[model samples]
Target: MVEPTGYDLLLKGGRVICPATGVDGIRDVGVRGGRIAAVADAILPTSAAQTVDVSGKLVLPGLIDTHGHIYQYVTGRFGLDPDMVGVRSGVTTVVDQGGPSCMTLPGFRHFIAERSETNVLCFLSAYLVGGLEGHFYPNLYSPDGVDIDATVRSAVANRDLVRGIKGHAEIGGFARWGIKVMEMAAEIARRAEIPLYVHFGQLWGLPESGANGEDADTILERVIPLLKEGDVLAHPFTRHPGGFVNAEGELHHVLQAAIDRGLTVDVGHGSHFSYRLAKMALAAGVVPHTLGADMHGYNTQVPEIPAPAGTPEEHADDENHPFKGQARFSLTQAMSSMMTLGLPLDYVVKMVTTHPAKMLGMEDSLGSLAVGRVADVSVLDDVRGRFVLRDNEDYRVIAERLLQPAFCLRAGKRFDADSPILPQAIAA
Candidate 1:
């Protein structure tokens, strides 16, 4: 009898790591019609149409960034293209964090999401007014903007693309208004049976006032009670007055209590989330349940720092300082940071891939390389070197470097890195 036809593409001789299964052995991955057909000790060269040898390199599941803001791309900033920043950097899925809301979802659905090569998901902002508005406060607090009924309608209408609800509850800036607004969002999420993604503030406090008012402890106290098991506490490591660290420079019990109660903690490493807090939390054994770039146009520039005096009005884009230029931390950079904190590579990989997928309730369909799963794959050149990984202007040592994607397969088709794709592919 004739042997069955082999796969369309085969990745050969790489150390395949499946964090879900705790498998980290050299293996070959076979792909057919954009699905992972097989992973084995070795697949003969002749069993596939094309083969790329990835000898001596580490192969893990394509990363899934749980937080980011890609809407800034439409406004002209330097954020890396989602596909390039993601697929090329070994990240296959990206959740656009609160970039779009009810009013702007259509634009995102058409202009950004449809045209991108990356697999993009969205966490709809609780505010109907969208993040790109001119006001410092998002319109969500406005009666017209905070219409939970409408938000729910929109979420249900676009259930396939809308993953959950997102809101930023910063203490001094918008916490007072945001608390009520997010409550509405939570109600809507509950009705829709979706998770709620909250960016809890550190500077703003409970009564919601003070220079370092909102501490992480207080924020967690109020927010944790409102959240269900699957709800996310994004940016759990920011070093603001109420962040992971207390005034005494110790890990706060409140933060630990929330985690213990099943609140999923995500390191949404944006412009403001503090590296100090991240280091402390890691040291305290608080591993981030997920990792995201929080990438926005301004935040995409590598080595992003404080803006010089009097540049332009456009710079005032996101009140959040870190999203102003290319973020200091890329998705891979975030993973590297976790590795430096003593997390094994497999565990770190899970935080970005499987964990986020499970958090979003898309695990069976998206995160793993199981047979019949979507053919989303990223290949990397594991460049060996020692380097520093920085976040929000703080630096840490990374003993190795992971080169960007050599090739990406999205939905069973190879994305041509050289194709006249707009927004040039970002270097890995």
Candidate 2:
């Protein structure tokens, strides 16, 4: 009898951790024609066209970044290239939250989503104008800016790419016109029959607020009623006002109620993340359901971060190559931060995989290692050493176990971790 052809690519003897299947073992994963063909104890090297020895690495489902911006040339200063944060960064899927509005959906489909190697999904911005310029124009985020009929229509038309609706329930907009904007956004989401991905916390610079003089402390009281089950509340760990931590430095009592109502708390880990605040929440036993690295050109590709302040180094020369740019990172760094905060490796892996996939409503097909599933996998180099991690608030934590992306397979195709956005190893 003739021998049957084997898998196209095989990952051998890696510590596979699939949150969906509760798999934490050394196994061989075989890929065939962009789908997972088999996962077992052993697959002979000759049984595949390319067999990679991943014995010491941590192999898991490809990461699902629940939040980021990558509309590229269209969003200009706010956007980064899709692939820069996607396949190259070991993230198989990335949800571009609020990057494209209803009007820009078609352009986004052709220009950004279809062209990239990484899979791009969108939480369509509720505004008809979309996330143009990152809402720099505060007036655009006002209630009047959201066109209910148009936004809903666009979402339905692009249902394949549109996973949910995007809205910004920030202090500036609430202050400007109260919850009128949020209500409109909520209505748009309702009509579209999708969840609303709401961006919370402060929207403006310090001490400035709504024209009606609504304070940040009242944000939850005002916005919570508008959120239904499946709604996403982002930026729980932000240092800014209007986030999970109240102005009095206490976790908001309403957080539990929102969770009970089935709302998802996504840690939109961005330039505003605060370790001090995050630790407080963890102490209160409130953990985010998902993690979204709010990476963008503004934070990652250098919108400018003044050099860190420290005591003078007497011996350093110009060749020392002083780190002058901002401390930007990908999903791997965010996962490391969660690990540093005491989340177990398996739990952290779930947050990036199962949790996010379920939240994005792609749970059935994504976020697993089941045979016949899309072969999207992430290979991580688990390094043990003193690694310094800093949050946006300048708070630091030294983590002994850090996960660095070595590469990723998007639909069974390989993409190396050569993106400039990957965080560099910080010497302890």
Q: Could you say which candidate leads in TM-score? A: 2
In candidate 1 the C-alpha lDDT for residue 294 amounts to: 69
- What 10-residue stretch in candidate 1 is worst by lDDT? 419-428
Instruction: Give lDDT tens digits, candidate 2, residues 1-428.
Output: 97355989999989999989878999999999999999999998899999999989999998999998998766655688889889999899999999899889999999999999999999998876677653345666767788899999999989889999988877777767778888998998888989998887876433243246778888876788888899988898888788888989998898898899899888888777888999998999889888998888666755332222331243122222222244676799999999999888888999999998888788887789888899999999999999888876668889898888989999999999899877788967
The CA root-mean-square deviation of candidate 2, after full C-alpha superposition on the true structure, stands at 5.8
TM-score, per-candidate, Cα-based? 0.84, 0.92
The whole-model lDDT of each prediction reads: 0.67, 0.84
lDDT of 1 by residue, 299-359 (tens): 4553233333443456443454434433344676566566656778778778877899898
